[model samples]
Target chain A: MTADHLESRRREIVLAALRCFAREGFHATSVRDVVRESGLSAGAVYSYFPSKAELVAGAVAPILEALTGVLDAVVLDGVRSVGEDRTPTEAVAEVLRRIYPIAVGGEVDYTRVAVTAWAEGLRDPAVRAIAERTYGTVRGRLTDRVTRWRDAGHLPADVDAGALGQVLLSTLLGFVLQHALLGDVDLDRYATAVALLLPRG
Target chain B: MTADHLESRRREIVLAALRCFAREGFHATSVRDVVRESGLSAGAVYSYFPSKAELVAGAVAPILEALTGVLDAVVLDGVRSVGEDRTPTEAVAEVLRRIYPIAVGGEVDYTRVAVTAWAEGLRDPAVRAIAERTYGTVRGRLTDRVTRWRDAGHLPADVDAGALGQVLLSTLLGFVLQHALLGDVDLDRYATAVALLLPRG
Candidate 1:
């Protein structure tokens, strides 16, 4: 196979593995399950992913990408647009508004997979590393925004950006978990609560 | 065996099952694993929990009790003692203070088991029912507190108790998940954010 074809096949296998993990969970799923789900032979799947841990790591890549994309589009964009007479609080409220629907809607497969990843991280060091790295990236992005907000005089000078960043990420993760478990939570009160946290002029 | 003896044996099996679920992800664990961990005969384990689902349900009982205890001690007490010159925000901050140590410390088996429960809830109806019911109980308790706070003029009259209750519970669960995934997250910022949510006198 050409290099392009090899990459496509690997993507196919990883997607199948993610579906299996989302449906049956990481611990219950084996490599054979991924092969069966992908409709590919054992050799083909094995060539792409040597083990379940590697498959999990591969599957999580797109999820991390999607997460970073949300942060950029929703959060970072808000910060950049703050110069247009928009308070940081309004910017954050806008981000929460955008996130609520995606978290509670049909596009929640990523959240489901994330919950499974947390469980898998307990037993597998490789999965744990991915989970940690994903959170680290999220925290880093959030901390950067918080620092900018503080420097711009939207946040209090004494506030620790890193700590606040962790809290923000944790709140977002909490929303994902609640949506996955309870389904269709009305986010108005949550949005209001979060709005109260942001700096007011 | 006497009734008391039977009760103790059942408790032992449930504890063992919880340990296995925490260590080995719920989907990967079998009744056989519980038997091995409990050091009991298969017949004895089977006699207590008819199936893996029942064992899971049994294992979750203590978790529910602990959760309710926290609600009563931290949240309910906060409401009752509102006349003691304590703001609702201070009550919640106190609760967060109590919870932070437990969630990040070695006594975090409950949080680990909770992560497994979320994954298991996806494929198992029994587990889903338990998870939902548990959240329902939590929300109900939270709603009662929100209503009390509003009625007592601590919360705005226009605030919806059910909605605010869900948000509060979601934030708490988010804290648990974050602490479980990333140990010893400094909760000062989180507490501050939540304090911002409470009505200022």
Candidate 2:
């Protein structure tokens, strides 16, 4: 296959692997399962992934990257637009509104898989390292932004930026879990309530 | 085995099954794994739970019940303690603080499983039914309390009770997940930050 075709095929395998992982847990899913799911030969799957662990990580990497990208864009862009004039509550709300759609639908299954992996990773050092890297990078960036907001005086002086960051991250995650579990439910109003609760200038 | 001894053995099997499920995904973890983990014979394991699904649900039921208990206690006791004098924020805080530890540490692993199961259940009718029964009861109780709080003018007049309930529930779940993932990180500061965000009387 051409390089471009190879890349496309890789993406296809990853997506199929994600679906399999989401439907049947990662370990239960084998290379053959993925090949059948993706309509690829076993050789093609091997050429791309090498092993189930790598396939699981590769399958989830894009979705994780996308989530991290959205979080950064919304938080950073919101902060820039708010500048020194915006109240923390408004800034927080704007951030939530921008990210709400993504939180509710965009990567819901991916996140569920991520959560599952993190939980499982607790007992396995190798998997735990991957899970930690994935979580810490996203959380670390948010903590930095919250610190900047605190420095700008947009937030209350007593606000622990890192802690608040954790809360904000947790709020969105928990909502996604609930939404994923519940099928259809409006989350915007709930997002607004959380926004209202954040510390203001 | 006597009925009581049989019940004890069953509980042991269920707990073992949870650990196995946590280590290996539900599909990957066989009855053999649970039997091995619990030091029980396969016959003993099968006698307690005829199916793996029942074992999974039983393993998680206590944790779910505990979470629901906290919410119920918060609503009931917060309202009772506040009497005619307390503001909405204070009353709610009273309830929330009481349940914070449960969310963070009590039955945390099974809670993680419950969350994943809830998401997975969306497409699986059997799992979905169990999730709905467990989650719906929690949501319904919170909705009723939020309505009472709003009607009594303890909360913002415009607040959406059902949605707010979802948010609150999600917030607790998210907080628990973060705390669990973070391991050694001190979360007391985060709890304080959350408490500070509450509207003052």
Model 1: runs farther than 4 Å from truth? A1-7, A78-108, A148-157, A187-193, A196-201, B1-3, B78-90, B99-108, B148-160, B187-193, B196-201
- The CAPRI category of model 2 is acceptable
Candidate 2, pairs of clashing residues: none
What lDDT tens digits, residue by residue, belong to model 1 across residues B56-146? Answer: 9998887577677777786777544555534444555666777555543543367788888888897899998998898888878777877
lDDT of 2 by residue, A97-134 (tens): 66555543552366456655655554456656676776
With a 3 Å backbone cut-off (N, CA, C), the pairs that clash in candidate 1 are none
TM-score quality measure for candidate 1: 0.84
lDDT, candidate 1, equals 0.73
Worst 10 residues of 2 chain B by lDDT: B83-92
DockQ of all candidate complexes: 0.47, 0.47
Model 2's interface RMSD: 3.1
